[model samples]
Target: MRLIPLLALWLCLTCQSALAAPVRVLNIIVGEWPPFVAEQSKQHGPVAHLIRDLFKEAGYEVKFHFAPWGRVYSLAANSQLYDATAVWMYKPEREQDFLFSEAVLQEQFVFFSLKARKLQAERLEQIIGMRLGGDIAYSYGPELDKMVADGKVTQQKVTDVKQNFGKLLRDRIDLYPQELRVGLAELQSQLDPASAALITHSQTPFLRNDSFVMFPRKMPDSAKLRDQFNQQLQQAIASGRYQRYFERLARGEY
Candidate 1:
C-alpha cells in the first residue's frame, strides 16, 4: 500500500512538471534587411534582437525564418507555418491579410544617386523624367507610387537591392530610393571602398514611415500575440530600454 501511494505521487509530480514547462515558441518569418534583420549580423541584427528580447519578456521564444522579401510576405500571409512577419511598412492592402503590431521602427527613405551625376532633388517632382530603380513589391509611399502610376517618373523593378544598385552604378537607372541605414549597409557590404563612395543620397528624405511586425490574420492567436508584443514594447519604450537598441545599432554593435 505504501509503494502504491509513492508511485502515484511520483506520477503526479512528473505531470505537474511537464505542465509547467515553458514551451511557447513563436515562428517568425523575415527577410534580409541588413543593420536591421540579417542572417550574417550579430544577434541577427538589432531589430531581430529587439524582437527576441520583447518576446522573451512575454514568455515566448522566437525562431526566425529568413527568405526573399516577396516570399516572406507571401508565406506569412497565406501559410500556417509562420505565426508572423517582421519589419514591414504599413500599407492599406497589407492590413487585409495581417494584424499589425505597434510600430517597431521608423525608417527614412531617400533617393540614392551617383555623386558624379550631381543629382539634386528636393522633391519627387524635381526628378520627373529620371529613370528610377526599385525593388519588386516594395511600396515607396503613396506620393511616389502615384507619381510612378501617373508616369511622371520611370521605375525599373528588380528582384533585390543589389540589382537596383548595380543598375544605378551602370547608369541604367538614374536613382534608387531606399531606407537610409539599409542603403548604406548594402553599399558597405556590396561595393569596394571607392565604388561605394561614388554613390550618394539626396539630402531630403522622400518618406518617413514606421514599420511593424505583422501577425497573419488566419492564425487564431494572432491578436493575442500582437497585443502581448505591443504591451511589452510599450513597457520597454517607457523604461528607455527601447531606445538603447537603436543606440547599439548606431554604434554598429548589431
Candidate 2:
C-alpha cells in the first residue's frame, strides 16, 4: 500500500512538469546600449534581464542580436528581416512598426568634449562649428537638429560609440554627443580603459530625459507580449527589485 501511494505521487509530479507550457520567441535585433542592453553578454544589462524575465513569465522565448542602432530601427520598421529590438527612443514615425510596452526606464542625453577645445556650451548655440559625433539616425532634439541644419554644428555619423570614443581619444572630434549613463557603460564595455578614459561627459544635456524599450511589430504575439511586459514591469518597479541591479552598475558590476 505504501509503495502504491508513492508511485502515484511520482506520476502526478511528472504529469505536472510535462504539462508546463513553452514559449516560442522570434529573433530580436538590438544595439549595445549599455545599462540597457550590452551585446557582449546576452544576460548583461538591466533591460535585457527584465525583457527575458517578463516574456518568460508570459510563456514566450526570446532571442536578441546586436548591431548599430540604425539597423535595429530598420529591422523593427521592416519586420521582415528581424523580429524585435531594445531601448528605442519613441519616434512618431516608428509608431506603426513597433508594439511598445510602457517604458522600462528613462535615459538622459550628455556630451563629451575635449577640454583643450574650450568647447563650453550652456546652450545649443555654443556648440556651433564643432564636429559632433554620434551613431547615425539617432535623434538629437529640435535645437541640435537646427544646429546641424544650419551648419552651426558639424555632424559626424559613426557606426558605434566604441569607434567614436577612439576618435575622441585621438582628438579627431570635438565632442561625442550622447546620454550620460548609457555612454559610460558602452564605453566601459566595448573599449579599453586607455581609449574609454579620453572621453568625458560635460553633463550639459541636449535632451534631458527620454524613454525606451524592447519592441516587436511583426509577431502575432505583439499585443500579448506588450501586456505581459507591462504587468511584470509594474511588479518590478513596485517591489524595487530592479534598483539592486543599478546599484551593481554603480559598482562596475556590468
Candidate 3:
C-alpha cells in the first residue's frame, strides 16, 4: 500500500541522515608537561583543554594519549598511531612530516644551577666547555642546538627533568636548561626541600619560544582538519576565550 512505500522511504531517509552525521574523532599524542598538558591537572591542563574546546566547537572529538616525549614524537611522526601530537616547538625537520598549529603557549628556556656554583652565562659562548643537561631528542632552539652540535658546549642527556635536577644537585653537570616555572615545580615536587632550596635559575632566559600542536601529514584529510582547527582557534582568541583560559591557568584556578 502507499503507507508501506512511505514508511520504507522514511526509514531510508532516517538511515541516510544518521550516516551523514558529522562526527570526526582525532587521536592526539601528548607528553607529560605539567601546567600545559598533564594527566593529573584539571582538564589535563590548559593547552589540552584549549585543543579540546577548539575542536569540539568545530564538531570534532579529541582523545589524548599520554606518553614519553620520545615515544609520542616518534609515533606521531612515523606511524598512523596518532592524528596529532601537541606542545612542540617549531622545527624545520618536523615541519616536513607534520603541520603545526598556531602557538598555544609561550615559555622561556632558563639555566638552572646550584646556588653555591656561582654559575652565570649571558651568552652561549660563555657556556663553552660547561656540561649542560638536557633531554636527548629534544630541541632547545637553534642556538643551543647548534652549540651542542658544534661541540661548543658539552651536552648530557637525561630521561626526565627530575633526573637533570638530581644530576645538577650532585654536581654531575654544570647547568640544566628548563622552563623556569616548570623547573621550579619539578624541583619542589621531586627534590627534597633542602636540595630544592639550594637550586636557583638564571635571571636571563636562554631562549624564548612558543609551543604548538602538530597534525601528521599521513592522516587522511589532515589539511581539512588543520583548517578547521585553525579556524576555531582563531575564533577562540578573537572572542577572548583563549586569553581568559590562559589567565586562569596562570593563576592556578584551573
- Write one digit per residue (lDDT tens) for candidate 3, span 1-254: 89999999999999999889788688999987876788888899888999999999989899999988778888998888788899899989898889988887889889998899898775677788999999756889999999889988988997789889889988999999988877876886688898899999888898999988899988877788788889998998899999887798779865
Give model 1 RMSD, 1 decimal: 1.8
Better of 2 and 3 by TM-score: 3
Ranking by TM-score: 1, 3, 2
Cα deviation of 93, candidate 3, in Å: 1.1
Model 2: per-residue Cα lDDT over 119-228, one tens digit each: 68656767778887888878776668778888888888888777788788788788788878878777767788766655567655778655656456666666766777
Candidate 2's C-alpha runs over 4 A off are 1-20, 81-83, 186-198
The candidate that wins on lDDT is 1
Cα lDDT of model 2 overall? 0.73
Over 4 Å off in model 1, which ranges? 1-12
TM-score of each candidate structure, all chains considered together: 0.94, 0.82, 0.90
Clashes of 1: 0
Report model 3's TM-score to 2 decimal places.
0.90
Clashing pairs for predicted structure model 2, backbone only: 110-178, 129-152
Instruction: Name the candidate that leads on TM-score.
Output: 1
TM-score of predicted model 2?
Answer: 0.82
